[model samples]
Target: MLISFGEHAKVVRLEILSKIGEGLQDRESGDRNTD
Candidate 1:
């Protein structure tokens, strides 16, 4: 049970990181478009 919980946490962390990365990329592209 503990192992499963740990794995779940890792997955959630990875998802959050990916989402943040995508957001940064979107902002960067938006800035380029404005210029």
Candidate 2:
């Protein structure tokens, strides 16, 4: 059970990181367009 919990945590972390990365990319593109 503990091992599965750890695996679930890792997956959550990866999802959060990917979301942040996508947000950053969107902001960068928006900045370019404004310029």
Candidate 3:
């Protein structure tokens, strides 16, 4: 159970990081983030 929770948290963190990176990239490229 503890391992499953850790895995879930890792996945969520990865998703969040990807989103932030994408937002930054869009901003740098002067594209519409639209969020």
Question: Backbone clashes per model, in order?
Answer: 0, 0, 0
**Estimated TM-score per prediction?**
0.84, 0.87, 0.74
* Top model number, TM-score: 2
lDDT of 3 by residue, 1-35 (tens): 35688899999999999999999997977755453
Write candidate 1's Cα lDDT for 1-35 as tens digits. 35688899999999999999999999999999999
Error of 3 at 24 (Å): 0.2
Evaluate residue 34 in candidate 1 and report its C-alpha lDDT on the 0 to 100 scale.
Answer: 100
Q: Residue 22 of model 1: what lDDT?
A: 100
Q: RMSD per prediction, one decimal?
A: 2.4, 2.5, 5.2
- Candidate 1 deviant stretches above 4 angstroms: 1-3
Evaluate model 3: give its lDDT. Answer: 0.86
